[model samples]
Target: MNRKCDKKCLELSFPAVEAEASKGIATLSARLTQNGLPEHKTDDVKIALAEAINNVVEHAYSGIASANVQVNCRLCKERLEIVISDSGAPLPGLRIPDGKPAQLGSSIQNLPEGGFGWFLIHQLTSEIRYERYDGNNHLCLRFDL
Candidate 1:
């Protein structure tokens, strides 16, 4: 990959609601595809981006209305960096695990309802980071080309 050219970045902001969040992911995926990201890697990027945006819609803006989520995508030589930010409440006791798939039980009854998103995000990206500042939550995900 060529890392020599000037870095390029894109920024998008939308309502911190489920509907708009989906649009945000779509827009990001389209932009990435236009920038020469491979189809398989673009699929991974879309999944990770959706997971991150959904987290904000589901967790951050619980009971709140009219809030917004901000997303910034930076294209570097070796990887693409995405930063998702929301003005809602921060998650308590948040942790970014090693990029490993969650162990699942054999039966469907043993499945969990809410823990898969983080695992999927970690698995799809090479790096993950989360922080809370000024009453906002910021999640960063990096995908290697």
Candidate 2:
């Protein structure tokens, strides 16, 4: 990843594998604070951003050779816009998931394993959008700053 740092924008690209994704997210969260994203909003942004990227790594790239995850964050006085792109399978039906909270089962062992990510993402971000063009999936998450 070629790293760039400033108060308004941070751009990075890395292989979209599990370990790399985690490291990428951590790097993003840490640098965001230095790039003028309000401290209070960094956690929310990090959580939502991680969920989105995890989905890409776990679902989009499943059964396929991993590719690059492109991240671009632009900070404005009113909002922060993060654009994450990958050349993986398009979202099911090419739209954002409904993201309803996952249903819980009674037993501890029955607890769902993987349904809460989108719900948490929706709760954290002000707006979310997705698109696929020219074989790349673009997910834009907006957080009011």
Candidate 3:
């Protein structure tokens, strides 16, 4: 189960990392559209957010079933702040690129295997940050509407 905040910002906290990756994306997408973001931009933001959370599930948790994922979303005047956290070992030396998908690597995995979420997120979002604290890995994505 997920908890929703009552403020302008909707915060959803989930226990399973994989479930959080999917449900969080849907909830945030709805909130973005409800908050007056255009349809095309909202779709893009949803895609990027899905990728970020998927990374936490696949890479951070390494398919472990006992991990927990926390998704906190805040809607401000200028942008939306999405925070995805997991109780797992921190990822070391993982860096997000700073450009479009074209500038990223041209590997078949991104196209045929569908592992391009992180790369697309790097290209689509305005800002992204990775943090590790007390054995928790957090990925924060900022999207401009």
Candidate 4:
């Protein structure tokens, strides 16, 4: 875990693996609060960020050597912008997912085990963007503070 922090910006770069993702998310949440992200909005930001990073770990680098996840957060007067980038697989079709909520079935046995990631991310973030260029994928999530 390596980070550079200042009054308005927090930058984090780490390996795109499960353990690192967990620690990175926790560390990011702490730094965000210290950098003045409102308490009420912290959970939203953290959830969205974790989803984004998990995608990079699970889907992006599924069969390839794990790469690094680069996170840059900028806090302005009324908004927080987070850019998470990695050298893993690009999003399918190089586009953002539709983020439809996973269907809840009639019984516990029929319930989905996953698929809520993008939906919750879209719900929590004010804006989301994805770009694939130069063999890298960049996902940006924004929150209105």
lDDT of 2 at 93: 97
Alpha carbon lDDT of each predicted model: 0.80, 0.89, 0.69, 0.89
Ranked by lDDT from best down, the candidates are: 4, 2, 1, 3
Predictions ranked by TM-score, top down? 4, 2, 1, 3
Q: Is candidate 1 or candidate 4 better by TM-score?
A: 4
Could you tell me how far off, in angstroms, the CA of residue 99 lies in candidate 4 after the best superposition?
0.5
Off by over 4 Å in 1: 1-5, 97-106
TM-score of model 2 relative to the true fold? Answer: 0.93
Candidate 3 per-residue C-alpha lDDT over 24-123 given as tens digits, one digit per residue, 9 for 90 to 100: 6787688767876666678778887777777667767675655667877776656677787788656657455443344334775555455466668877
Q: What is the lDDT of residue 110 in candidate 3?
A: 50
lDDT of 3 at 46: 80
19-84 per-residue lDDT for model 2 (tens digits): 999999999888888767888898899999899999999999999999999999887777888999
TM-scores for candidates 1 onward, in order: 0.84, 0.93, 0.74, 0.93
Error of 1 at 82 (Å): 0.5
Report RMSD for candidate 2.
3.9
